[model samples]
Target: MDSILNPSTLKNLVFDLGDVIIPIDLTAPVRNFAMLANLPEDEVWAIWKEHNFINHYETGLLDDAAFRAEVRQLLKNDVWADEVIDTAWNTVLLDLPVERIARIQELKANHRLFLLSNTSPIHIRRVNDVLTQLNLPTLEQLFERVFYSYEVRLAKPSPDIYRHVLTEAGLVAEETAFFDDNAANIQAAAELGIQAVHVQPPMTIIDYVKDL
Candidate 1:
């Protein structure tokens, strides 16, 4: 528990999905793409990063068809199947630890919990499938509201998204706390008078709020 987030004053908790609740392997996609494209891993990674297609897709600027087309074009492999593209794109997602969900369930007793994530439809569907496979509740059942970048057309580190969450949840900035693995997103929330924690590896959400 950070001193800035005095438990006495916080009434709402906003969480980021990737690397916060769900563990992700950022390099997994690169490896997957390399295998799919039959290209060197470094070359595939360079192409992926240079295209910046992910940002557009996550932000809702690109739809599924367009995203797939862009991926094929960027990788210079026009003959790849959609399944191959999807598999490679989704390799970045790993698993959602059950302990993390249990911790969130515990926190529900005290504060209004919400999920704010920068994600695409493909990734979210995969995550939901995992939850179902594990017999855990869907995200909507676990959190009061789940906000996704593709659905909302807004991404974190953007002030508008934070403002939208506060307004939609009917929460006051001063009474809310946000936890994210990204420093930029945390700082954006803090700038709006919300208590923000920069969650890092080896420090899970359970550790952050257990004391509070």
Candidate 2:
């Protein structure tokens, strides 16, 4: 994604929740798991990669109880309660800076902002709690509409989800800008003719749209 922005051409700004609008440390949960299991982060990370079933929860294939059961099994003799497991697992979600909310609101003056994220119910619930703590509006209040993988049953890097957003929002592919932290999602949006911004570290949505 270019550092400059052309608000004239980009009328709609579509954002990803994690690591985009909200700052999240993907490795935080792994580190927490490592602490729980008293193992090295690398070992826990490797195990997590091998047994990544959170996607099932994100795609709504597994309910919260089922997903928690999977986590319990993953930990192997942790015997932690649901609340304990939820707090540990939800460490993947970091704080949502009030500045990010302000930036989004500033852009919302001219752009139709929308949120699309691949997140599970637990994460979403935790996010709202964070928002409440920060005195920020709900995700729906911040954006025109929010599309969650769990609710929509469609994950990103899949053309179908992008198509669904386009159709549902009555947005033209050429006029929309999709900002995400994932390269695959950026490629998917680009392939569908949307302006895709690869929002990597040290560069945020604020930097991506600095010109606007």
Candidate 2 per-residue C-alpha lDDT over 60-134 given as tens digits, one digit per residue, 9 for 90 to 100: 989899988887787784587888778887888866777888888898888899999999888888888888777
Estimate the overall C-alpha local distance difference test score of candidate 2.
Answer: 0.85
Clashes of each: 0, 0
Residue pairs clashing in model 2 are none
List the candidate 2 regions with Cα displacement exceeding 4 Å: 1-5
Top TM-score model: 1
Score every model by TM-score: 0.94, 0.91
Candidate 1 Cα errors over 4 Å, as ranges = 1-3
Q: What is the C-alpha RMSD of each candidate to the true structure, in Å?
A: 1.7, 1.9
lDDT of model 1, residue 172: 97
